[model samples]
Target chain A: MRHPYADLVAHAAHLLAAAGLDGDKPTVVAERLVRADAMGHTTHGLALLPAYLRDIGSGAMTRSGEPAIVVDRPAAVVWDGRRLPGVWLTARAVDLAVARARDYGTCTVVIRRSHHIAALAAYLTAATDAGMMVVVASSDPAAAHVAPYGGKRALFTPDPVAIGIPTEGDPILIDISASITTAGLAARLTTAGRPLPGVWALDGEGRPTDAADVLSTDPRGSLLPIGGIDHGHKGYGLALWIEALTQGLSGWGRADGEAGWGGAVFVQVFDPELFAGGPAFRRQTEWLAENCRANPPIDPEKPVRLPGSKAAAGVARAQAEGLELFPGILEALVPWAERLGVAALDGRA
Target chain B: MRHPYADLVAHAAHLLAAAGLDGDKPTVVAERLVRADAMGHTTHGLALLPAYLRDIGSGAMTRSGEPAIVVDRPAAVVWDGRRLPGVWLTARAVDLAVARARDYGTCTVVIRRSHHIAALAAYLTAATDAGMMVVVASSDPAAAHVAPYGGKRALFTPDPVAIGIPTEGDPILIDISASITTAGLAARLTTAGRPLPGVWALDGEGRPTDAADVLSTDPRGSLLPIGGIDHGHKGYGLALWIEALTQGLSGWGRADGEAGWGGAVFVQVFDPELFAGGPAFRRQTEWLAENCRANPPIDPEKPVRLPGSKAAAGVARAQAEGLELFPGILEALVPWAERLGVAALDGRA
Candidate 1:
């Protein structure tokens, strides 16, 4: 069933408010979740609301509080998210960095202990809309699903990074993980008894395999890094840097001990006006985007597209024609709506 | 034949000085080039000196001049390198950024129109030795050898990024490019009448192939991004970000028309002490490094090593013994050495 974007957000926000989130946290979380769905990141979208509500019930995610400022420099900041909702915490951090960047040209905010931030791309538009470039990266130190380059045992998470660049037209939103495939997709494929599209995972014995179930086996197989078996060292290096930027700069991570369902984040915003004139920056990016789009594709029927072009188109369609929740997502949230005594999405006015 | 490290640097510097580089520029270029060779980056090492001499002879590289400061802020800067030696210019930029990062927590310097920066890793230790984390990336707007994700025609250079993270032991130095392999390797393989190790490139029709000569074909094939065909969008995104950070930030790029064999570079330095405190940062990174090393390797005979471990060992061995240039590198420079009336490596003291 398709639901209006506004209705879904409102319903989700109401359920979240009833569950415990205070102030504007419910609205912020709801909007970001819905936005992720609109952008076609089905796994990280509204499907996560049930888990978030459960976290709230168990007091895993802090309901109402401002992140404790760990360090505040003119151009840099460290924030203790205090187990707050990652969606809200990350959004707030981007805003803070954007505002501060005006004065300092560039500003970076590192957050420790932020509860599972959903869909990094959802938070990028806030910066790009303001004609700024932003970079966001996150890692869950308590969870390890990826092995280092040559090692078999898991030692790191996917370590995703996103960047937002504003051109003359729609902004370019880049969201990528250090690994080839994410844990969520792997689990989904395993549950469906489907093999991966390629030999993207390694077996327990360190041989390449297409079996998603390997991830669940004893001495579990691990997801391959972005460059796969041949050039995985590049991905390994990228993962380490993400770890340092998020966990190291935040001053808390796996070395400190396991934290439940939480992650460390790094957010940076740069004002092009402060480096080169904004016009010149946009002019160069616009040219590149145009040329990239014009580049001849191998398949004549399929044209080359920029990173965010498809997502942007999806968002426009969702906004105009309403959104169709992936099967089981809305149904799963219906029970949460009932338990919280909030109007179900279907019952919305 | 192996030559003493100091003797190689001195001989290279003499050749560069005779070729036209003035003051400390020759020594800076020579040291960085030799350091790359010591670190096992043979392609980017002394093998590039002959090209540098040729660029100098053609007046493509400015021998001596101060860069024009385009923008100078407390935390951000832009420099017009005016075709200056990128090796020296980048080294100076790192020093400037490191110095400014002390007062600003983080500092970034973008250089436009710089001659080819030899090796990104060669410029990392200066910042890491000072207990700072540094990021360096470069893109030559004049060159295009790597194609966009879905496109067959080339739209980008290799677009390399390097990061240096300080730990209690050796710093983790990561140097990677957005492409699966570089044009240098492709060209070398083509010249040797050899195929690539894997299908790391695409044919003109966008079919994956291992033939390095495809790159020299009429409708030239292009190098694949790091993730290759299956997940090249990630690498394409990385390449775009590197372009934005280096060329977009510098306000001079492909859109401004190609100006010979030069590049735009981005350098950033961050002080851990300014955020979570240096001790805490190191504690976390050190733990990660150790655990990664101990993780069971796929092969018992080969243990998991950090990114820079092998390079560090190579440098140590070179210092203790002598540096060995690639077989053709010394011979390639002999003609230039003789023409410039400089003492050759074989006659070094």
Candidate 2:
């Protein structure tokens, strides 16, 4: 059954509020978490609510006041999240960055000690709508689930880089992890007795293995970098840089040797009006969108889909006809809703 | 026999000079070209001199004076390269960006109508060494060699992105293209009758194929984005944003529809000191470098390598011993050197 997006947000906020999130933080959390699902990234969407609640319950990530402004320059900022939920901390950071971008044509904001900010595409999409392009990169020093390109051991987090650009038709939000597929996907494939698309993971012996061979016992396989073997070096390079920007710039430790909890992030916001006139920038963006859409198609059934097109469509559909939760996602949230005494999801959850 | 790097630069400079390029521009071109080879990017190095000479000779990419500063903001700049060699234009742009970065914490310089900047690693390496971080991305609005992800025809450049980070030890430089394999490599694989690694390319029918089956006729297959088939969405997204920044921001056209012969470039330089203290930034970079090096290798023979480690080794070795050109590089250059009346490479070629 489909539920209005607003109901999901209110329910999520209610649960978060009952779980000790005070002030407007619960709304921030609910909104971003719901948008993840609305934007078609169900992996980072409400499915992660259990983990967030666990983190909150265990005091692993605590709600906090405004982000601590460690370093504040006209064009740069370092926001210590004070161990806050990433959704709340990043929401504050984005506003600061957008404000700074207005003053300086560009702004670089580094965040530390924040939990997973959820889907970066959803986070950066706002900047796109604000007529700015943003590049957001994050690394969880705590979660080292991806192996380096050729090396087998998991020494890196599946670092993600997201870029959001404003277009007339739809804002382009390209958010992708450095890994070809996620560790979770690899696990699913292992259980399903299916091979991954390619050499997208390595077994415990540090040898390449088909996904079907990733047994539950002995050594578990690690996710491969984007491009897998052929050009994994590119993804590996992207991962390294993402780490440098997020971890290095934020002064958070690397994910390799010792990783604590929380995340290190780097956000770069740029005002197109600074370089090209806003109108020209908009017009050129339209030109690019047109040319990309006009690209010759290999499959008659599928045109060259620009980044965020599908997600945008999903969001538009949800806004008009209501959003549908994954088959079991709503049901899975029933317990949390019951435990928190929040009103149960009306759509059979 | 192999000549020293300086001689190679000098010979290259002489050739460019012979091709009507005078003043410091030729030397700038020569140095960057030679450095590309020294850094182990032979494809973009002197091996590309033939193409460069042809472009200059054809007047498609002309040698010009310093880039014209069309829009200059404290933290942003729009440079009209006036169809100059990318090396010179970018060299000047980097300096201006560096200068502006010093004043504004961060600076983004956009360039229009520039030739190939060769390897961005070398260009941004200077910034890294100077205690700043820089992200460089370029798209050739005129030449589209890569198909959009899932699309058959070429609609995008093999758009390249590079990031450089400063550290106390070896700096980090990550330079990568958006394609899994280059068109040139695909062609070579086709000619050699060797199957390409994984499903790295497409066949003439726009279907995925191994390298050996690339029948390069009517519908010559285009190179896939970095993630190939499974996750090419990531690479496509990267290509789009890179285009928005380089082509869109610079007000240059996209690579599709109309063809041109130059680059639209975006270079963002940020001082790490603005966020983390310079000393802390340096220490953290060193920490990251050490952690990356210490990462357990999947193979005993190959350790995890940071982005620039291999290139650094190559540069160090080339400095210790004379730089050696690739097997056919010197031979290939001999004709151009001979045509320009420059002393031919003293090597066997």
Candidate 3:
């Protein structure tokens, strides 16, 4: 069952507000959450709402908290997320960084103490829309899921990184998780009681296992790195490096870091026109896109997809025919919408 | 046979000078070349000398050509490598980028018309030494060898990307070829009469063939992307992204664009302390390294190696026990050394 994108967002926002988040914060948070669903990244979308609501309700996440700019230099800024929702804070930080990049040529933002950042691709889209190039990385506490290459225990989060470049028509956005298979995907499989693919994970005994009990493997059952079974070392290396760049540098999440979800996030944005002449940069980026798309595909029939091309196309389709929303998401948001007095979601439950 | 790193460099410099390279340029060019050899990256090392010398002699590359800063912005710079030796220009460009990063907190440098860059790692090491994070990419013309993933025809050079981050002991350097293997490696194996590793490449008909003759296959052989045999699309994606960032943005080489031996390169440098407090950033990076290294190995005997740890360890070993030179490499530099008036190898013919 599917719902319209707006109703899903309205429901989620209503719940967030009912849970104590005030003003533009819920609106900001809901927009990103729904955008993730619209872009088809359900993992970072409303699937996280229940946990988010619980965190806020239990005071693990403070709804009223505002990110503070701790350090503001000409070329960089460090923001204490104040335990705010990562979606809102990260989006704000990236926006500020892009504005600074336009003035300073390049700018970086270090965000500390933020909670579950929804799809990183959202912030990159924001930066690229402003005609900036951006590289962003996120780190979380030892979800204890991914093992370093050649290592059996979970040592790092399958840290996610996103790089976005502005081009004509649609910018190139590359969002990659250092882990071979995303935890969310694995969790979905586990929930569905389906065996994981061979590339998904390993057992405690250092053997390949398809068991859907992903978290049960815990310190023993670990996620494989991106290059899969043999080359996971590369992925492990990349994840650890991202960890260093984001959470490590933010000065938070160090103590008890091996446990749960707290870490740093880093976002850097560049104005391409700062290096290449603006027109040239745009023309060249477009040319590169066309070159790849126009090149004879290895299969000749299949089109070579540029990183963000599909997402942009999806966005277009959503705008035209409404974004799809899952049934679980809608069912979870009904009570909150009633509490927030936001009106029922489009004549559905 | 092992030779002093300095001795090999001198031979390379001398040879280039004899081939009409500017006298002052040889040392930088040679340093980049031999550094690759010293680091055990033989593919990008002295093996490239013959081709480079040929380019210089043929007027495709020039000595005494100074790169001009074409664009200067707070966070970016564009330089015409002026057909100068790639190593010399890239070194200067990256150094300039580091300086800019120090001043601006972040900086990007794009160089066009640069000749063959000996080793991507060399440029990354420079940024790390400056306590900055770096991403570097370079694209070359179709050398008629390394293939795009899944293709029979060689469409581009095995364009490579290297990323580095600053750490306490040694910076983390992760350099990888877009191609699973290099043409030179294939050539070396053929000379040694070794059977090709399974799935490393495809023959003229696009069938999986490891005859090493994949390099000589008519219609030209193509190197598989990084995933080795299956799902090389990931590697293909990475390679295409790097090309877009560097050569694509710089308008240096398009797969079908202007024909030239020279290519474009892009380097980005970021000062971590700029975004994260200096002390916090250092602690974060250190913690990241510790967390990764603390994990127990699956093989028990084989420990996890961080990205640059091997190269740093290799450097230490070379410093103590002297660098190892391949027999073939040592034999090839004699004529060049004689031309430059440098001392020739004692054991070489």
Candidate 4:
């Protein structure tokens, strides 16, 4: 059912607050999560709420904590998230990066011990909106589905990445995971008793399997890199690259250290206006988009869609007609809302 | 047969110098090209000598030209390569970035109107060797391969990116092109009458085709991305991101402009010693490499190899034996060398 974007965000915030995330933390986390859902990225959306709540309850995640600044230079800063929510810390870090970029034309911020940042695109959204370009990367110790390139066993997380560039017409955003298929999506398909598309997964023996049950306790399966089973070296390369930028460079969660998910987060923001005039930068990007779109479509009826164009449209639609939530997601959050004494979602209670 | 790496580099330097790129320019260009070949990247190796010679002969490339610094700030700098050899200008820009990074802990350098930078890895190697982590992305004008994610028509170049992270054991180096296979590889195979590997290209109809001939002058085919036809959208997104970072951000080579093989380069450098203590960063990265390596390799005998490790080993081997040159590649460069009044590579006049 469709729910108002604000309402969904409010519900998420309330739930987090009731679960011990007080202050602006809830708002920060909620906004990022709901924004993902609004942009139709259900995998990174409300589905993670349960796991986050569990982490909070287990004391694995810290609430009401301040990320310590370890290094603060003119063009760079490194922070220790202190196990705080990644959404809040990453957003703050991106803001810091943008601010520094404004001053120096470019800046890089690295954070260690950060939690799962729900949607990286949200952090970059602010920067791109401000006429800046940003590249954000994060790594986690506990990998789920992604196997190392040319290997059978899971050795890396999906290790998602996002890049945003502002344009006068529409900002171009490219958000992607190194994995061929997301574990969350696989889990969802498994929950719904559906088969996966193509050979996006593998069983423990390095054989192809479409069964989602492979990821359960027995752990008989893993997700393939973006190139799937045959040529995943590229995805493996990408995941390794992200790991270096975030974990390797930041001196945070090394791939071999700590079994659980935790790592360094790196965000770099570049203000085009610092090097080139803002108008010119925007115009160039717009021209690029137009040229790509104006080219005759492979299918005459279908025009090229810029990277963030569809997401932006989804967001606009979500804001106009409440967010569209899966019924299962709404049901799952009901009991949690009662326990926290937070307001239930608008369409359910 | 393998030859001494120094021997190969000297040969390339002699050739480029004979082509009018003398002094530091030939050394810089030759070093990057020969190193790439020694590292097993034939695409960016001596194979490019013919094109470099052709461009120089046509006056499309300058042997000796001063790259004008267009913008210089504390955190960022932009250079006008003036259509000079990409190696010289990019190396200079990398040095500029390293200097700025040394001071501010982070810095970026962008170069416009430069020629092909043999390999992205070489530039990162320079930064990482200086004890800084680096990320570099570069793009060429449109090449007829790898359609943007959705549509069939090829619109973007197979943008290349390289990232380096200083590890306690060995710096991690990852260099990748946005496309699944490079045009050079495809062209080489097509010329050799070799069957393409497993649907690496798509016909004009967007259907999978393994025929290398599909990439012929008729241009009836385009290359697939690392993820194949469907997953190329991710590759497309990445290329667009690189474009924004290097070209758009620098206000050079706007997308719609007349297309040619020009490079827009972006280099980012960060000093680990500046953020966390140098010792701490080393310890952290060492721990990470250990964890990754120790994680019971999928194949025990083939243990996990760090990114730069293999390349370093290759360099060592090449230094002992010299850079390996394919017969076809040698044949292609003979004419160019002779035209430049240089002795042929066989060592006889």
Give the candidate number with the greatest DockQ: 1
Error of 3 at B164 (Å): 3.0
Judging by lDDT against the true structure, name the best candidate.
1
Return the TM-scores of chain A for each candidate in numbered order.
0.98, 0.93, 0.92, 0.93
Candidate 4 per-residue lDDT over residues B169-234, each given as its tens digit: 577788877787777788888878897777887777767878776666454667776787656677
Q: Give the residue spans of candidate 1 off by over 4 A.
A: A347-349, B347-349
Instruction: Give stretches of model 3 more than 4 Å off.
Output: A209-212, A253-263, A298-301, A334-344, A347-349, B141-157, B190-198, B202-215, B228-233, B248-251, B338-343
- CA RMSD of each candidate after superposition: 1.2, 2.7, 3.0, 2.6
lDDT tens per residue, model 1, B1-349? 7788888898899999999999999999999999999998898989999899999999999998789999999899999999999999999999999999999889999999999998899999999999999999999999998889999999899999999999999999999999988888898889889999988999988899999987789778999999898889989999999999999999999899876999999999999999998998998899999999999999999899999888888888877788888779888988997899987676442
Specify the poorest-scoring 10-residue window by lDDT in model 3 chain B: B141-150
Question: How high is the DockQ of candidate 2?
Answer: 0.62
The residue-level lDDT of candidate 2 at B90 comes to 83
Question: Considering lDDT, which of the candidate structures 1 and 3 is the better prediction for this target?
Answer: 1
Docking class of 1: high
Candidate 2 interface RMSD value = 1.9
Worst 10 contiguous positions by lDDT, candidate 2 chain B: B252-261
Candidate 3: give the clashing pairs.
A217-A221, A247-A264, B147-B222, B147-B223
Q: Tell me how candidate 4 scores on lDDT.
A: 0.76
Q: Candidate 3 at B5: error in angstroms?
A: 2.3
Q: Is candidate 1 or candidate 4 better by DockQ?
A: 1
